[model samples]
Target: MLPLTLRFSLLALSCMLPLAALAETPLSTERVTELETLLYQDCGSCHGMTLRGGLGPALPESRMNAYSRDGLAALILDGVKGTAMPGWDGLLTEQEARWIADHLQNDNPLDE
Candidate 1:
């Protein structure tokens, strides 16, 4: 039988493997659009039609996209400190936030 320490180590390593795989996978554009539409209809009620900022801060010009996917995921999970941006961890998943980050990084269609 394996020693207790070795057994625990193997268990931990095995648990982390799936998390690492999940971290590497990115959301698809179609999922991104679906999330965007949800954001527009729900969060957009205050954030603006284009997320150009309204009652809430503008997201398009924000440097949010420059941050790592994990960073954006945290923001979505843990709302902006003292801001109107509510924590969306309950409403959205990390994958969805990553999708939002990807979409926000692109040039606005109106700017073209």
Candidate 2:
């Protein structure tokens, strides 16, 4: 019923729709500041203010880099089972979690 070109266009749009949905909006400067504080204070409550490890394991850049960005973001949002690590889904957006993951992997204090 549809022209070949029309069908091809529809298929292309369908493929791109999922990607568009997955695209995250940019975070604001103030939101970034808040996220940084949360990462250092709230998450820091367990990972340590300096991220040197406390009740939770240390979050060195090396270790952070070991995880894929999306994987780490999922972990941040979902929390580990049978552990003290609680999910942040209630308090954070997926974009925020990814931002935190990026910071831990790239801008973390513990370079080693």
Top candidate (TM-score): 2
| Local distance difference test, each candidate | 0.72, 0.96
Question: Per-residue lDDT for 1-112 in model 1, tens only?
Answer: 9999999999999999999986756667787778878867776777778776688866663465567767867777788878788888888887787666555665442232
**TM-score for every candidate vs. truth?**
0.62, 0.82
Q: What is the lDDT of residue 89 in candidate 2?
A: 98
Model 2 ranges off by over 4 Å = 1-19
Worst 10 residues of 1 by lDDT: 103-112
On residues 9-98, what C-alpha lDDT tens digit does candidate 2 reach at each position?
A: 999999999999988779999999999999999999999999999999999999999999999999999999899999999999988999
> Model 1: runs farther than 4 Å from truth?
1-20, 23-33, 107-112
